[model samples]
Target: MSARFAFNHATAKFWDQREAVEACARAGAGIGLWREPVQEMGVAATAKLVRDAGVAVTSLCRAGFFTDPTPAALEDNRRAIDEAAAVGAPVLVLVSGGIPDGGTIDSARDGVRQALAELAPYARERGVTLAIEPLHPMFASDRCVVTTLNEALDLAAPFAPEAVGVVVDTYHVWWDPQVWQGIARAGREGRIASFQFADWVTPLPAGVLTGRGQLGDGCVDFKRYLAEVDATGFTGPIEVELFNDALWARPGAEVFAETKAAFERVTA
Candidate 1:
């Protein structure tokens, strides 16, 4: 089964936001936006840009990190939800933050549970779905406490499917032995909110934040992912979100074209 494509703006982190939107618009593809760029352009203006260009905003990159759930953290997430609604984005992707200082992963995960309970109603009221993204275990210490789809699904279960769901990014979950089962479960639970792609590469970089490989450049078998997710009856846009530093350094238009081609070739 062939999947529709969406370009995640982070794939070209340095590209002008308008240019990225225009590129996606020209290609008749969907786009996933990050909050920083949207805020930098002003949410209303960014909304107008996409609306005018006739581009679809598949999901908003983030709105979680509640290891602290500070008043500020929740406030920021509220604002993110508002931004997502303003831009007509149905899903707000969340990376449950890492453990707080002096705290264990278990403790931090508790905070995420509490935060979700508090925010789910708010998000649902606004018709925005908060998609919990389980980052790879490599980032468990610093980036996200949610390191597995099973864990993400568990966290999202207490809430209604319309308010909370899980993000399936191949780069993050492909290594898990139970990923296929996890995908099946997400489907049965009606919680597969967003599906993203980025291949895994080796020789860990210093930060490990921007080392994502192109679609076919690494070990991710995207065909398998498409099959598994499609078998579950999910026909949403498959967003390609590479964080490779080399791709970010190149012209965004070229990167977009190349990434789209890679996505087509792998899913073909």
Candidate 2:
């Protein structure tokens, strides 16, 4: 399956931004970036670095966390859109914020709806797609209210494709019984803004943030996912965004090499 593979820098969260870009450039691979490092390095400077290296910034790590819809949060997200445009990445992945204090999960989801309604136009103006990522259900209460591709698509359906979309991350939605159907529906709706790969493993670490297993290290049926997404005629970059602490503890270069190999092995 001729899928275009990209490495998400969160796999080595401590890696220097320049080193990650250079590694991706050397491997002829695309990269997914995070906001903290981009901000620390200066958005324009990082943009120049990626441009100089001739590497594709597949998508920016995140922008939306608007469970409260505070003016400050919206402003921050707007800044993220500009940064994404500056870096030449078409999509700004959104981790829909968790439940707000004194609020239910449903209320948090409603907040996401309001936040999207407010930000979609801004993103469209900047030529960036706000890609809502439905994190694993385990994180539903504290990390992301959007917990499945179906929910994400429903959230995105109200917007134009270029203005808003959804992310299909294997680690997050692999356990959903209707995942394949969700992928199909996402394709039919033209909202698959991001396709990410990460295996789900047991003994989720404290906070369950960096517990993603390496590709083929868990039960994800990557080949089936690839084939299903392919059937939708959605030809886009496939990114591996592992958040394993073990991988992060290793050298970024070594981790990058191992990740690329794992991606190739399972996707092949």
Candidate 3:
């Protein structure tokens, strides 16, 4: 079976948000937009534009980061769910926020649990699924505290199918020893909300967060991932979400073309 591809809007940050979406539509690619870009375009307007362009809003880039577990944060996530619903996006990717001041990773995980409990029902009400994305363990200090697909699935276990799920991103999780098992569990539990691809590279870049590689530029067995997820009957859009400075420096159209080519090649 062939894999369908989606482009995360950040991959084309050089272009205006709406223009990026339009470009993806023109390229016959699905779109995964970040919240800020969507806000800049106005949720309703962006939604309408994407719909008019005949493009699929595969997923909203993010909504979680509710580590504070405050009422304000929960409200913000609720609003995010509404925005995703407006854009006809079924999945709202969630990055469980980093460790709070003087807090342990375990404590941060607890905060994520509480945040999910509060927001899952709201997301379900709005017909949006919250997809918990586990960032790389290297980011366990300052990015998402959820650092593995297994942990993410365990976190989403309590929620019903439409309320909570997990996002599997290759850049963040490809190095995990238990990734295969996690993917299988995500499938068995029906928690595979989104599947993102970005190649992994080494050399300890200063800003490790933004140095993702193009699909074929690094060492990732994407075919293995595709086979694992496809075995779960997950035929959802495979989103390319690279954040490499090199790719970003290029023109949006060039980046889009190269990413699409890479997707085709890797999944071939």
Candidate 4:
């Protein structure tokens, strides 16, 4: 089980990219990368760094704030797909942008559908899968409007599974009564592109952007989630992707070590 643990860069938002890669390499773990750090390091350089370190990049953090789907947004998503390919990451996790200006939630969802149609083929051609992530409903207004696995799957259904898929992040979907059924559906359709883990804690902080709880410090049932995902024949990295501000304030190496331990404990 430990062999499948992966560290997502955002968990240690302030860590140096090179150091993070080295740490993952030492632990014999995979990594989930974010676009900004990759861009700052130069995609080519980052690719070589991970390659040389013998670290596998499980997925790329994002590239889908296209509720408006402007020409620039589409182009940026295209670049993200390209970057994922360069870094040897098979999945590009996408968070559909919230409601656009003057648009209702329904309209925003339609925009997501349009954006995926335009970008799925591009992603496929680059050998990357666009994995749509549904945030918790509380975030439906500003961070992501697609707030359930079922909704995400509906958006992905039009495209080939190879081109589009969904992310099953524990923090966001653990409360959904229908999540199990949704996971089964995603698996049967061969659309489980990414499986991320983040615990859900109560009394969410102001804005709630970076309040993801550490693995065992909250309410998530990691073992059960593992069982369901494993039953799906999805044998991929289980990325630890917390967004806690407290973790960010600490030294990254310390957070990384602690997170790795917690992951092993919870998932063991």
Pick the lDDT winner.
4
- Candidates' TM-scores? 0.98, 0.97, 0.97, 0.99
**Compared with the true structure, what per-residue lDDT tens digits does model 1 show for residues 109-141?**
998998999899999999999999999897887
**Candidates ranked by lDDT, best first?**
4, 1, 2, 3
Whose TM-score is higher: candidate 1's or candidate 4's? 4
Q: Which tens-of-lDDT digit does each residue in 1-268 have in candidate 2?
A: 3239898999989999999999999888899999999999999999999999999999998887898899999999999999999999999999988888999988898899999999999999999999999988878888898998998999998899999999989899989999999999999889999999999876666747878899998889999999999899988999999988889899999999999999889987
Which residue pairs clash in candidate 4? none
C-alpha lDDT (0 to 100) for residue 248 of candidate 3: 80
User: Which regions in candidate 4 have their CA more than 4 angstroms from the true location?
Assistant: none
Residue-level lDDT of model 3, residues 1-268, one tens digit each, is 2237899988877668877887787878889988898898799899899989999999997877777798888888888999999999999999888888988888988999999988889899999999999998888878799999999988998999789999999988999999999999999999999999999877756777778888887888999999999999999999999887877888888888888888999998
Specify the poorest-scoring 10-residue window by lDDT in model 1.
201-210
| lDDT comparing candidate 3 with the true structure | 0.88
